[model samples]
Every structure is written in C-alpha cells, then in structure tokens.
Target: MFKNIYFVCFILILSSCGKDPLPKPSGELRLEYPAHKYQSFNSDCAYSFDYSTFAEMQNAKQSCWFYINYPKMKAKIFLTYFPIHNDFALHVKEAEKLVYEHTIKASSIDTKSFSYPEKKVYGNFYELQGPTASNVQFYVTDSTKHFVTANLYFNSRPKPDSLAPAVEYIKKDMLHLIDTFKWK
Candidate 1:
C-alpha cells in the first residue's frame, strides 16, 4: 500500500512537468481614445478659434479667461485672453516665466514656433516632459492687439507614464486651435 501511494504521487508530479511554468509576461496598461472632432468657437472676445467639441467650455473667474474641460480625462486647458495695448512684451515675458518655472520637475522642454502671417498669428508652443504641474504651455498673439496664453493641467498629480496618452490627445487639439486661430 505505501509503495502504491508513493508511485501515484510520483506520477502526479511528473504529469505536471511537461512545460516549464513561464512567469506570465509582464502586462502593460492599454488605453483607448475616441476619434477627435472640432467645432468653431467664436465670441465677442479678442480671439476666435476651433476647439475640441469633446471638451466643455466653462467660464473662468475672468470674463475673457475660460477653461476647456476634458471631464473624461480629468484635464483642463486654461485659456486667458489679453487685449494688448502696448503691453505685449509684458505678456510674453510672463508666459515664458510660467513655462520656465516648471523646470524644477520637467526633465526637458521642447518648443515649436508657429506663424500664420496671413492671419497675423504667431507664437511659441512649449511641451514640457516630466512629472510637472503643467505639462504644456503656449502664448498666441497677433503681436499687436490680442494675446492669448494657454496651459494644460490634469486634475490628479502628474504621472508622465500614465498621462502620456491624454497629453498627446490634448496637444493635437491645442495645435488645431492654433492653426485655426484668428483675431476679430
């Protein structure tokens, strides 16, 4: 009886040994985003542009300052409009200052300048890479009468790895706005 029991145990162990157990391959988080679309946004303010229809526009504390909220992604693009009256330099300086302030946490920053001379639109767009409060910033202006500065922020703490997708999606939207931007 003891021999029979030992033989059965041996067979069971052997049967389980056909394949080496592979450590299950590490898993990566998969995120899916919807196809983006935009609509024209124009007001009596100094600026007009196309904005993502996916985001809801909310009035901010100031009249011309408002937020484009992405509720699904828990992000917001805060936009401020300033009517330049010989203070264009001041606004530009402040925008650059705000972008530089994130240097402490930003591993790197890349900038791309855009201009539509026909539209009198020109500005620098900054993409901040790292775990920072604001990962994107830009100031658009006609260089004379209208200056608009925008910042992208997530409601939660910045996690570059997890937030990469959202950042990219919103970045495209920002670019669209810049492309279609004009002053009335």
Candidate 2:
C-alpha cells in the first residue's frame, strides 16, 4: 500500500515539474514583408527606388545616399544611385574607375589586397568590388531625358560567405523590385 502511494506521489511531482509551454510569437512576428517595395524617385530626379523592409534606410552625406541597417544580423545595405550624362560605354567605364578608386582607398594601408569585377546581374550591366565594399551597379535609360544607375553596397571585410544567406535574401527582394521596376 505504501509503495503504491509513493509511486503516485512521484508521478504527480514529476508531471508538475514539467515546464509550461512557451508563448507563441505575436502578430508582428507573424507578419511577412512583401517580396519588394517600389518608390518613384522625386519628380525632379530621373531615378526610382525599390528595397525590402527587411532592412532600414537612412540618408548618407554625399550625393551617394543613405545607409540600410540590418541590426539583428549586424550588417548594412547601401544604395548610391547616380545620374549620368555621358554615353553608356563611358558611364560603365566611369563605374569601373569608381570601383578601382574605392579599392585603392580602402587598401591604402594594405597594398597586397585586391578587388575584383563581378559579372553583371540580369545579363546587361556590370558590377565591381573593392577590398572594403561589394557593389552592384547598373545603368538604365529610356533613350532620352534620363540616365541613372542603381548601386547596391555592402562591407567587404566580412566574407560574403558569412553573409551569403542574408545577402541572398535581400538580393531576391531586390531582384523582384528590378523585375517590376518602372520609371514614373
């Protein structure tokens, strides 16, 4: 009789010791961002803007624009869209020059470091990388009245391998934006 009573008490205690279930994430956690967002550039400018809310945006000091922050992941996404007046080939050459300049500037203390050119995305443009920044730059024009570029930047010190997943996520979002992009 005593053994039976003890066994029941032990079982009861063990069952009571089990932890309570964790609460589920709230509505905010459940919310999902659209694949992308599109914004026409200011009426005076010949550009357009598209990005994912997965990152936050802020303005930069120079004509080059703002900073995009990914706090939880400790990363940044940068955009610098510049207007060009030169011919397409010249604009592309200038973009390459800018990449070289950035690489030299970033690697001033370490001449051994090098930057590389990345293949164009969407098959019609080009991109370049520096020792300190990875850039995705491409030009767009409708044959007259507008010539602009969309440049995406990220710190190069961090091996892209480490940030690949997040970068890919953002890239997919950006790709969606590009696919649907239309000048206003």
Per-candidate Cα lDDT values, in order, are 0.92, 0.49
| Model 2 C-alpha lDDT per residue in residues 1-184, reported as the tens digit of each score | 9999999999999989877899986532222334545443343334445656666766667564556565555555554544535565665566456555655434332112111123112212333333345534444444333444445555445444454555556656555545544455
Q: How accurate is candidate 1 locally (lDDT)?
A: 0.92
Top-scoring candidate (TM-score): 1
lDDT of 2 at 124: 28
Q: How many residue-pair clashes does candidate 1 contain? A: 0
Global fold similarity of model 1 (TM-score):
0.85
TM-scores of all predicted structures: 0.85, 0.49
